[model samples]
Target: MKIGELSHLTGVSVRSLRHYEKKGLIASVRLPNGYRDYSPLTTETVDTIKLYLNLGLTTEQIAAFLTCVLKNKEAFCAEVLPVYRKKLADIEHQLKQLDQIKTNLIDRINSLQQEEQVKNE
Candidate 1:
């Protein structure tokens, strides 16, 4: 398919698809007419790319993962597992910080409520 079709199917902007090509995250073949021809695998590849981006992985990291996946399809899981585990650990640490913030906010609210009650009485 062409770039437009790939963009529409993936819901990624044509500009982004082009950027992906430039970033080496994806490839496009030049047709005789000078139009870029993209393969059907572009959809699957774009989907995976989007997934990694959503997970806060950097472009370089995504590229590395893609290289591994392509070179060792059957063992990609083994390679990806460590990266995901580290991400999970980071998320857990952030969650703990968020929990502390929530606790502090709740305590502040309770303190204000108590002060308001005392003022009413």
Candidate 2:
């Protein structure tokens, strides 16, 4: 199929499909007329890519194990375990930082409320 058909099947934009091709996350062949041709299996690859992106994985990270997963027809490859762990750790760290920020905001709000109460008294 052509690029447009792939885009329609995957519900991904043409620009994003080109971007995926450029990122080496997906592959296509060029026809004599300069139009890009994609395999029907490319639809499954695009869906997989979208799943990883939704999980907050970057294309570079996905590229690291996408082929393995695809070739093996597995949910994940051995190489992706470390990536998943690292991403989880990063998210945990961010959650801690956000919690600290939330605490500070609460303290500041309480302090201001106390000051207002005193002023009104």
User: Which segments of model 2 are wrong by more than 4 Å?
Assistant: none
Per-residue lDDT over 48-106 for candidate 2, one digit per residue giving the tens place of the 0 to 100 score: 99999998999999999999988985554788889989999999999999999999999
lDDT of 1 by residue, 7-90 (tens): 999999999999889889999899999999999988988998898889987777777678667656726457577777788999
Instruction: Quote the lDDT for 36 in model 2.
Output: 95
Which one is best on TM-score? 2
Give the residue spans of candidate 1 off by over 4 A: 30-35
The TM-score that candidate 1 achieves is 0.79
What TM-scores do the predictions have?
0.79, 0.93
Q: Each candidate: how many clashes?
A: 0, 0
lDDT of 2: 0.93
Model 2 Cα shift for residue 75 (angstroms):
6.0
Worst 10-residue lDDT window for candidate 2 reads 72-81
Look at candidate 1 and give me any clashing residue pairs: none
What is the number of residue pairs that collide in model 2? 0
